[model samples]
Target: MLGLLTSIMRVFEIPMAFLQRILGIKHLAWVFLAPNLILFFLFAFLPVFLNVVYALTGGDQILLRDRAFVGADNFAVLASCDNYLDPNTCQKDLFWRAVHNTGWFIVLQVGFMIGFSLLTALVLNRDIRARGFFRSVFFFPVLLSPVVVALIWKWILQRHGLMNAGLDAIGLEPVLWMLEREWTFFWSVFLSIWAHMGFYTLILLAGLQAIPRDVYEAALMDAATPFRTFYRITLPLLMPTMLVVMVLALIKGVQTFDEVYAFSGGGPGSATTLLIQYVYETGFAGAPRLFGLASAASIMLALVLVVLTGLQLWATRKNADG
Candidate 1:
């Protein structure tokens, strides 16, 4: 056994030694990874480590002098329905309500956005006349900033805005689009869907274009109807792109803050108060800022996002495999 091992090592050792010398393999590996290592530690790892520490500390302040270890008290307080700082008002406990509202928002907005975008992509991908012009027109909204889109929609949904003006022009009363709770929430969903659908449509359109034309022709020759071809060929092939779009929309929808914040300010009785905005308000808006609580909430929100993304990726992979 020792003689055999010695012979094998001798056979391979020369090439290994040559490679180490020529490649400077030890240093070469680090050279390839050094920039990414520095960036990951600086931008990604450090902030997350610091935020975890911050979440475990007490007090309304984040300055090192004011922070002290309080263990899981902040998290516990947040988990409870009762307010951490104030005992009297349940409305002041923004964490639970924010979670619930954000969940609902993701469900409704993402559902509509993905469906609408897929439909639009299908229509645009067909060989209709002036298809390029129509595709460009449909996707134009995606180029606008979220704040700009929000403000534009705010004007359109306001009582004296374009929508109301049109209603009045038609000899009807100008309904309060943003002043009422139900209408305001509905308008928020509408605007979010409208603004975001364009980008997803563009993404799906690119995916649609990538599919080989021969597959469709083969399906046609096989006597597959359009719907059957789409189900068996187009959808299966498009799963990769659809998965990507779904994950992107899910992440964006859950973290949505600016649009709702700018549109109604989560108004008409906290109708659109998403988790991120709630965290912002808790940390910065009120007197005696609850930095620890806000950090805890932020950590929870981050965890929720991570878990959701993980589940989506896993489910999509399983479906693809099966």
Candidate 2:
């Protein structure tokens, strides 16, 4: 009876009391929400606004008052290129190279990432030997710190590292994995997939498990082949989860930085330098830091992410309608 009274009070008495107050119940929800709203305004939106301000201004000063307003000159400088095909012809070769590398990275990484994750999830979802152990084994990499993962791979891939030592034992040539442009890019993609595939696999595995066993049983009773059943029933049911995984993987691939930076340091002539790395280098890594250009690049990256998000939403709506 006491608990019931407390619930009743919560639902009616408190609300009615609030309504009777001069600072009324109409604004009470905002009163409760104001703390979080203020924090978001201060921490999230404020920095973005500052970044836009910085992008529109020029000169070496970090202070807003000291900076000169240069409009879109920074953007124009980024756009100044004889041919977009060749970074060599561009005024900002490094930025273009970073863009090119990031584009290829996202394409290759997201594609292989989806394929490998789906394969792992499918295998693990089945009745197999040491299934629990295998799932844990795959997921262990995802649990490790990104810095730790990068360092481990770096040690293995270095010139005088374990990989080279093993190659020598097998009478194979010591591959300079990080010293070449192609190898650096290849390793970046490879490392990213290896480290992150487990998370996507877990997502897919959950989706797979959520599927009713009766569906598969029905398909079997119908004398349906595994492939056909998977195509007709499983694929259709899994599309929603797959879409979520794809969008998440896409965003993660775009935001990739820590692993690539820690692993390769964007080495071998900017081969693996991503947009985030380029922004960091332009703004902080070098002397005479170009904050305006970095801000412009940051804005460009934001636009790419916005487009990707918009596409995901559209795809989701289409799938829902279908």
Candidate 3:
């Protein structure tokens, strides 16, 4: 066994040493990075570049060669509106409606997600009974696949599902969770938060635990109230983690699709139709595929995401350094 292992090592080691010598030690790092860089270029950078190319053209044609350059007409049409706030006034009303819904969705989702995640983290951080069990229970949702998460919530929220059954059992009126527009949108946000808040709570939990025990001890010694201690010591110390959480949550909120799509079907008169769903429906799902228009909308979405991505990267890097 020892001889065979040595033979195998020798068979593979010689070329690595030769390449290392040729590349030099410092430059050799790029050798290992080459595969990842190539994959990223092919899958990430290439797709983005192709999206830009597609956005500049117009046609139902899916092939790059067949698309005739329209040079921002899709964008122009999207922007053509008597009132920016009213989707009905826009040339591409669905795009605007999705944009409007996405704007509100992101604001509410990120704010409430952070608030709820922080609260969950705080509760989980306490030295209470079944703390570990509670932490696991809260975080379990985060591990479920997005489609699975959506389906679970869908079954729960359906008129004949667990939620309405509970309501009936409790002598309350059964409300339409997915049929009404407003209620559908409400579930979109609520389901999104329920699926994702656990991961953010874990982030905040680590932040909470990293605080110096003596700081809280001193606060207790000075007879600081719970709120005062949280406000004065805990919050200030947790700001770094909070910043990362907010940026990440914002990005996730913007990119939301699968769960909400499966949950609401982007229905109830397009009430829950998000920007991502718009892009998907335009490019592929809908008939006479508006590939160019979809590409344009996607580019716009990507631009916003690019900015948020930079912020998240900065926050994460800063957090690691601190």
Candidate 4:
């Protein structure tokens, strides 16, 4: 093992020595960085380039060469709608329906996520009984795979499952959890919040912990009430972290597919289907896979993510400046 290690080290050194001789010490950083740069270009940029190329072409075909250049037709199709408010009037009605559903999902999911995560953080930040255990219990769901979490909740909430069984024991009626549109959407939002709240709670908890103890002590000396203290001290101090959580929650909400898909298969008459689900179905799940249209949808999703990320950066910078 030692001899093999020595030989490997010598082999690396030979190239390093040759590179150093050719480029000199000033450019050595580029030599070391070249492999990582190459990998990033191949993995990240190349896929994006291909997606853009596909987006510009029209295709029932999968290959770039076989795909006819159709310019912006794919995007135009997506944008074609008689009434923007009524997605049912759109040419790509399913896609528009998905967009509308996703918009609502983001609104509800982000609202609940921020509210519950903040409450959890506030409660867990205090000196409480079994604080570590409580924190771990809250965070454990986050460790579960999204698919597993969805499946577990599906079992629990299904009519014949644990929740309904418990309701029956309590002399209550069994609710149709997965077979109704409203129930399906509600459960999807609830499951998403349950599965991921811990991560945001952890972020808020850290922010709470980082706050100077003296600030609170001074607030106490001033005889500030708990509500007043939170409003005047805690909230202002916690804004940056909360902003981070909001941005993350928004991005995650927009990208939601797996958990919702696994939970309800975007069913109950497509009420729970989000934009990502629509894109996936368009690209791969259809008989004649609409690759160009899917690529266009992907570009739109990418633009949304980019705008969100840019806003986050701008907000973070503004916070820093202040």
TM-score (all chains, Cα) for each model: 0.83, 0.91, 0.93, 0.96
lDDT of 2 at 239: 84
Off by over 4 Å in 1: 1-25, 28-32, 82-92, 312-322
Give lDDT for model 3.
0.94
Q: lDDT, candidate 3, residue 124?
A: 90
Off by over 4 Å in 2: 1-20, 314-322
TM-score of predicted structure 2: 0.91
Candidate 4 C-alpha lDDT tens digits along 159-251: 799999999999999999888899899999999999999999999999899899999999999999999999999999999889988998998
CA lDDT of each prediction against the hidden true structure: 0.84, 0.91, 0.94, 0.94
Worst lDDT run of 10 residues, candidate 3, spans 71-80
lDDT of 4 at 263: 90
The sequence of per-residue lDDT tens digits that candidate 2 reaches over residues 1-322 is 9999998878987755765595666777776788999999999999999999999998877888999999999999998999988999999999999989999999999999999999999999999999999999999899988899899989999999899999999999999988988988998999999999999999999989989999999999999998999899988988888987898889899999999999988988789999999999889887778899899999999998998898789778876785
For residues 68-96, what per-residue lDDT tens digits would candidate 3 score against the true structure?
98998988877799998999988999999
Worst 10 residues of 4 by lDDT: 313-322
TM-score of 3: 0.93
* lDDT of prediction 2: 0.91
- Residue pairs clashing in model 4 are none
